[model samples]
Target: MKLLFIALAFIGVAVRFAVFVSPIHEFASQRVEFSVPTNSWRRVSEGLFLYGIGVDPYLGDTFHETPFCLGLLSKLHRVNPLIIDILFPVADILAAILLYLFAQNFLEQKVVEEHKVKTSFKKESQILMLSFDCIRTVPKLVVLCYLCNPLTVGSCWAKTTTVFTNLLMAAMLLSASQGACRFYRYISLVFLALCTYQTFYYGLLFPALHLYFENFAGSKTHCRSRGDSVFGLLMDGLVFIGSFAIMLVVSSHIMGSWTFLRGVYGFLISAPDLTPNIGLYWYFFTEMFEQFRSFFIWVFLINICIYSIPVSVKLRHHPMFALFTLLPLITAFKPYPSYGDIGLYLSLFAVWRHLIPQMRQTLIVSVMLVLAATVFPVLWKLWLEVGSANANFIYAITLVLATSQVFFVTDVMLAHEKREWHLKHGVETVDKTGKRLELHLQ
Candidate 1:
């Protein structure tokens, strides 16, 4: 298994490097699907140029990255420009490896939990339990899915900063899964802080992470009371807040001011740059009336964040699944989303393979996604290069992508619920009287 992973990693790196050296990468970087105003490598290069000449890159509208990212990129460029190119593929490979590790640990814990709860499940449902062979194989398949995904490859070739964010998220998940280790919990919180520092909306992940810690604690030792669980949550929350505060203070010190607040988080919220991307925000805000802009901005921001509460509550027993569901929601509604964000969550679908049999919209959602990908570049060229199409052309595709994502998320959630019902009851849908029973998820 180790050898298989190493080989897969090698091939993944080779594929990314091949794309890097090819002419396709230049075009990939310019694609609207991969490069948004906030994450574009071209924008980053412009920011670095301005910074090198002792000018504030954030003063203008060209740069929207955090000071930490800017400083890190500047140092890497100084060491060797080649290192900058190499870092993208390495980041992607590392994220995949971290996800693989997370899946393994999660599945192990899942098996243990299932064993303990099997007595409560109907005898007929025993067959629905995960097989040892399935547990052993799923992690490798997850790694393969992530490493070979075209969106993941495109993001790496484009050199978007979302790759780094995905890496931090994967590390956070892996650390959070190892709930028995105090050090891993601290590491997880710190990574979560970094993710929030880089992208403000990622702060919503705090609830899911807190629940994961609580679930792990409860599983490891059943003696802990509700008071103990609440105390643990408080400590974790404080650690996360402290880590975030330190990042902000250090970032301010690095830039000699707090201008990045407006540049990074402010830009995300205000949607000031209307550069077309594969997100719903740019188009809607571009056409929004001036007086109503603030109202709708608040509405949209709330819409993006409000799902975390219910999703966390509903998936309390399955915090990892909660995290996975939230990722798609973030990607769908975020202000300046790119293909990297989509790829991140799509890769994680492998972690829930058990629910695949229960999903009903698989074929329809797959078609919508493929169609959106195929037409994005065509519409962009027709609008920009040929002048035959318009902004509506691009906006239409964004809607298609967003709708497909919504369908996919809801489908997965329903599948999870159905599977749980079957486990507690029986896989057979007929009643004792031999009449078909109806199961509905509200």
Candidate 2:
């Protein structure tokens, strides 16, 4: 199994290297599904060029990456363009490896927790508990799913900066899984800060991380008191904020101004660029009335931000699951999402494979997603290259894709609830009176 995993990793690397050298990468980079204004390597190149010529990259609307990212890439490009070319594939494989480690650690922790509570569960629920073999197997499957996922591969091939974001997220998850260690806790928050700095939407993950560490602190100290929870939360929050502030200070020094904030985060919040992508933001805002744009913009932005609250509350005991669910929501609704965002969340589905049998809408959601992926490029070609279709065609598919993702998230959440219920109440579907009892998520 170890040898097979290594071989698969090599194949993943070889495939990415092959794609990087192929003409297909140019076309992949151009695809709206893979590249957006925020993450596009083309935009990164444009920004680097402007910086090299002693011009502010943020002077216009070209670049939307953080000053830190711009500075790092600029140095790498100066060293050798091939370094930049090679980094994406390396980052992608590293992300996969991190995810594998996270899965292993998290599953181990889960087994220990379940073992402690096994007596509370009905005897029938024992069948649903994770088998010893599963803990050993699922981590490799997680890496396999991530490395072999088409969206991940295409994102790497396109050389989008989302690759780095995914890598940081993976590192954050792996660190968070080891939250019992003080060093790991600090490292996790720093990685989270970096992710949030690059993409503003990721800041929402702070609540989930806080919950995770709070739970960990309670478990480790055997103290579930309110004061202890609050103290832990305060400490973690301070570390996250300090890390983020340090990045901002460094970015200001690097750029000699704070203009990158307006260029990077402002672009994300304002939805200023309407170049169509997989997200729901562009088309609606593009055709929106000029007068009502501000009102609806707040509405839309609030729509994305508000989910973190209820999802955190509902999944408080399962902070990792909350993180998993919120990621796809961000991908589906954020202002400038791409296939890479979709890829990140899809790969994470491997972590919850135990819930698959309980999920009801998986088939329909899978079909919708596959159908949307198949039609997205077709509609784009018809609308742009062939001129037979219009923006409606693309927007319609985006809506379908978004709806499918929502269904997918909800299905998983429901599956989790059902699994928990079955564990406590047994797997029987009949009531005391012998009538069938249905489980409804609402």
Candidate 3:
């Protein structure tokens, strides 16, 4: 496993480095929202220039990335290639490694814990163990899945900021899985805030992560009865708010005012940029009228933010699944959806690979994923480059793309519930009447 991971890591680094230096980098960086101009290595260099000139990168509306990221890249503006080439691949490698460790931790925990409950009428007792052999192969699989993933490589090579978000997310997951570890808990909260700063919707993951911590104490009441639970939740909340506020303050100071907040974060929430991507938001708002813009913006924001509640509650017992469930929905609803964001979830999907057989609608989901991946570029070309097709053409592909993701997420959620069911019901869940039990979603 070590040897396999080492090889994958090297190959991943080499692929990203090769892509960075290759001619194809320009094309992919410019054309794909997966590597948008504002967040691409090239534009990052442009933003870096202002930092060198003692001007704030966040001073203008041209840059959309986090201030700290811009400052980090600015420090590398000169002779940065030497380190820059390694930075992205290193981030990818780190994310994979972190996931491997997280899987190990999760699986180990599963092996140690089981709840046995006897049926009222039957002589049989059911055992619930949340962990599958889920760990033994998981670490290696995540390393392979993420490092060898084409989209992951593409996003890394394109120097898209989403790669960093993926890294932070991986770290956050690892930290959250570490039960009773105060250091990791604080670190997770900080990273969570950083992710929200970078990508607004990531704030939704807060509830899931918090729920994980709450239950990591063994039970809800156990966690609640402990004084640390109250203090810990309070401290975590403070850390989250403080970290974000500090970042905002530092960025605001650099920019000479609070204007950057509106220029950057506001642009994100308001849907002003009509750049085409896989999201459902851009075109819908693009076609919207000036008079009704404010109304629709609030409606869209509310619609997007509302899901975090139901999802967090439904899968609270399965916090990791709850976290995973939010990805596809965000992909479909976010203001600036891109393939990079999709790639993050897709690579992470390896963790759920064990549930493949139980996944209903797998065929339809696979076909949709394939269609979206292939047809999107064609439609994008026809709509933008060739001008032979209208916006509707690409929008149609995006709809398919988002629908495919939605189906994929739903199927996984269904599979997870089934697995949990099996953990309680034995291999066969039949009644005395010889009827099979079925699962249904509300």
RMSD of each: 1.8, 1.3, 3.1
Residue 67, model 1: lDDT of 90
| Candidate numbers, best lDDT first, in rank order | 2, 1, 3
lDDT of each structure?
Answer: 0.88, 0.90, 0.76
Q: Which tens-of-lDDT digit does each residue in 159-230 have in candidate 2?
A: 999999999999999999985888999899999999999899999999988888878877878858888777
Ten residues in sequence with the least summed lDDT for candidate 2 = 12-21
Task: Predict model 2's lDDT versus the native.
Answer: 0.90
Better of 1 and 3 by TM-score: 1
Measured with C-alpha atoms, the lDDT of residue 370 in candidate 3 is: 80
- Candidate 1 lDDT, 356-392, residue by residue in tens: 8889999999999999999999999999999999999
Q: Model 1 TM-score?
A: 0.96
| Worst 10 contiguous positions by lDDT, candidate 3 | 116-125
Which pairs in model 3 have colliding backbones? none
Error of 3 at 407 (Å): 1.4
Using lDDT as the yardstick, the better of models 1 and 3 is 1
